[model samples]
Target: MLQIDCPWCGPRDETEFSYGGEAHIVRPSDPDATSDEAWADYLFMRTNPRGRHAEQWCHAHGCRRWFNVVRDTVSYRIEAVYRIGGQGPGGSHDPA
Candidate 1:
């Protein structure tokens, strides 16, 4: 029963959203020059941190828009919520 704060739609039930996986993933600047391992890493590698994690979530049932959320993996407590292009409370990556 997580109450997610949608940037455009306010707080809403967790059921209204879809988990969009880990945030702050950077795409290759030159895909043509990128190696296969690098491309594979981009497609597969993810940092599964145990403490606070930054992630993307989409408000599917409400606004149909995607946003970012900072949450504690152990306690499931939301630290902050921001739009897709915005930065989390303590995050450095822009996610845009």
Candidate 2:
């Protein structure tokens, strides 16, 4: 089982969280104007990085607020987790 470090709750089992996918993905300004490719990209595209990866996740069983987690996808090791506004171990980004 994967272990994740919750910034507010400390290390917890992965079952307590929900994967929110890639962290930095931004939606188009105008969804109506989005093309088929753009829509497809938004719906299906994802960055499956091998090493360090920034991803959005929800501490479902803890704080209801969403947060970012920087972890190694290969080893399933967590690097850090932080709230949306607070400074994390690395950097912060607007929540998706």
Candidate 3:
């Protein structure tokens, strides 16, 4: 079982949280005006990077708060945990 360190609740069992998906996915400003293809892309597309990926995680069984986690996809090792609304260690917005 992997242990995830929650920014608000510290380290906890991975079972206590839910993977929200790749971070920094910006919602369309005018969804209704967007084309079908664009809408579908937003709904289904994601980057499958090999290293250092940023993602969102919700501490469902603990604090119920969401935060950003910088992890390695290849090794499944967490590099950093950060709170929402703040720039991650890499100096980028933790968007989702």
Tell me which of candidates 2 and 3 scores higher on lDDT. 3
lDDT of 2 by residue, 8-91 (tens): 878888899999888867788899999999989998999888899988899899986688888888887888777765565655
lDDT of 1 by residue, 1-96 (tens): 999999999988999999999988899989999999999999999989898999999999987998889999989999999877776686555634
Instruction: Give stretches of model 1 more than 4 Å off.
Output: none
Supply candidate 3's per-residue lDDT for 34.
96
Whichever of 1 and 2 has more TM-score, that candidate is 1
- Measured with C-alpha atoms, the lDDT of residue 74 in candidate 1 is 89
- lDDT at 70, model 1: 92
Which numbered prediction scores highest in TM-score against the true structure?
Answer: 1
Worst lDDT 10-window in candidate 3: 87-96
The per-prediction CA RMSD against the true structure, in angstroms, equals 1.3, 2.5, 1.8
Q: What is the TM-score of each candidate against the true structure?
A: 0.92, 0.77, 0.88
Clashing pairs in 3: none
Per-candidate local distance difference test: 0.88, 0.81, 0.88
